[model samples]
Target: MADFLNNLRTFVRVVEAGSFTAVANESDCTPGQVSRAVTSLEEELQALVLHRTTRHLSVTDVGTRFYERAKVILADIDSATDEARNATESPVGRIRVHSSPGLAYSEVATALASYQASFPAVSVELKIEQSMPGLVEEGYDLSVVSATQLPDSAYISQALGAAYSVLVSSADYIARHGLPRKLTDLADHALLQLESPVSAADEWHLQSADDTHLWTITRTPFRVNTPDALRAALFAGVGIGTLPTYTVADDLASGALVRVLPQYHLRPFTVFAVYPSRRYLDAKVRTLLEHLRATLSPALANAMEIVETFTGDATAPPASPPKRVAGTARKRPAKRK
Candidate 1:
């Protein structure tokens, strides 16, 4: 019976490929062997599965129904084999992870380093892309994403943390343009804008305890599609820009960029670790998620501090301001009440 079932599987493969030669090539056997297997399978089932001509193979209605059943059966057998192997093995397998390029460089890369160190048996393949790929169709075990909310899908999402974005400029630019003490003051300065996926003119919206404010400031003097490029531009004193705190922690610490509007804050964005249904959850995927959760908690705390240093409090003793240089200072008349 086992031999018969094996031969039936080979017949199913040949039927699916639509040619004995193709199935033979895939199964690493001769076309004659595939023909024999199909013949044997048909004898056992007492039904003709294919109508063969000189040029093509056509499936009968019964063959079509049998093919459908065989496909499901083959899938179940594959799943069973995988589950059984996982029960004994140390969860060793290749895990493919997809993430946004900016987050991949900033946070995901660090998290993966620790994860790989801890799980020596598992291998990770990370791809940074802007488009959301289908997890199952693409055969990715996991993905990390930052978005306003969880996407509606069958995939399971675990919240890693919240990302806070803030408007920032180089200390030199702020010194040259004068600080924007209020939302209205933003119009007077060169505002570096991030182009959205949907449109070019989307404005940065900010909120505070008392009220919400929208600024239609000028677009970035030089626009780039990526967050890393925007960060570089801000560092180079291109213009004031908005970005996630995690992407600019080191720069903020070094005073390369200073946060604007310390009084009002922008809305927070959510980060999620998403994966397909847990049925085929590989060991690498589980370990990666664990590592990320453990590592990102403190990292997120530090990121919040960057925001706090700018928008929350500056009670610490002030450091000496930079020396005035060309295009580094703005002359403005005193405001009248």
Candidate 2:
């Protein structure tokens, strides 16, 4: 009965549209195709739904009655279909996300705020760490990490965006110490380093056209384990520090900090959202991923614009060489000897 009613509505649309050709155009099909579908539907119901001529079309008395009831049935069918699709795809339940302290506070937090508003049924638990947490060990459903390369693991990794590290300092620091016009000039100036446990302890690597440079000396007078702390220190005129473009975008915009080495570029790091393997993932994760993909595209584009605004360079420098550090080791003594 429902199937017959559904077809009856299609027949009615053809009649209202004035001709099968008009209905076919509206339905994105050929006139003959629409005609055949109507014919098949009529045969299945053992009823002639319309009186058609080369000039016009008119619904029969039975067709007119069926159209009145068929519209209601068709509306109900559409409502049911929409509900089913929404239930299967809607973001609901609890989701756990782990991210770096910097991103957690800046982009990730903002993205979650909008996501929450759009999907009220979903509850999000965010954990901020200095480094990417072990997804299985920490029991996180998703983790955002910045890395040069993704390891060969069972987890799925999607690149949310990319950013490069830049040496930056407060205007006061530069005014007092003077900006270093060359890479070698930094040896005489103070440097601030990120002391995250999960990151390499080696020298900061920089790249230029056909040249690779490494600044390894701990000439860094101040060091912090987190990006937030590093930003605060830099804001306080601690020293020249290397940070991601997104992290310093606002500060750079406000003229609180200025780019130091405009010629040399640090290696570009990729931001990835890692998730466990699953044949049928939960709707919440899928929806969040979609939101992230859509939301991050424009954010990343803006980040690139900020980079260009600060660097004043049109071409990106070459990639830097990989440097090993104490952080990557499996285990280490309590203190460095």
Maximum-lDDT candidate: 2
| Steric collisions counted per model | 0, 0
lDDT of each: 0.71, 0.72
| Candidate 2: clashing residue pairs, number | 0
TM-score of model 1 vs. true structure: 0.68
Per-candidate TM-scores read: 0.68, 0.65
Q: Which candidate is the best by TM-score?
A: 1
In candidate 1, which residue pairs clash? none
Model 2 lDDT tens row, 1-337: 7755645666879867878988888888888877787787889968887888887788888878877877787789889887657655776777899888766765777787677888999899999887677788878888877778878888998998887777787887888888888888988888888864324544678887678887785555787777777878887887888777666665665566678887676777788888985556767778888888777545654655565565542122223312212121121122121
Alpha carbon lDDT of residue 315, candidate 2? Answer: 25
How accurate locally is residue 121 in candidate 1, as Cα lDDT from 0 to 100? 75
The whole-model C-alpha lDDT of candidate 2 against the native structure comes to 0.72
What are the runs in model 1 whose C-alpha is more than 4 Å off? Answer: 1-84, 87-89, 196-201, 312-337
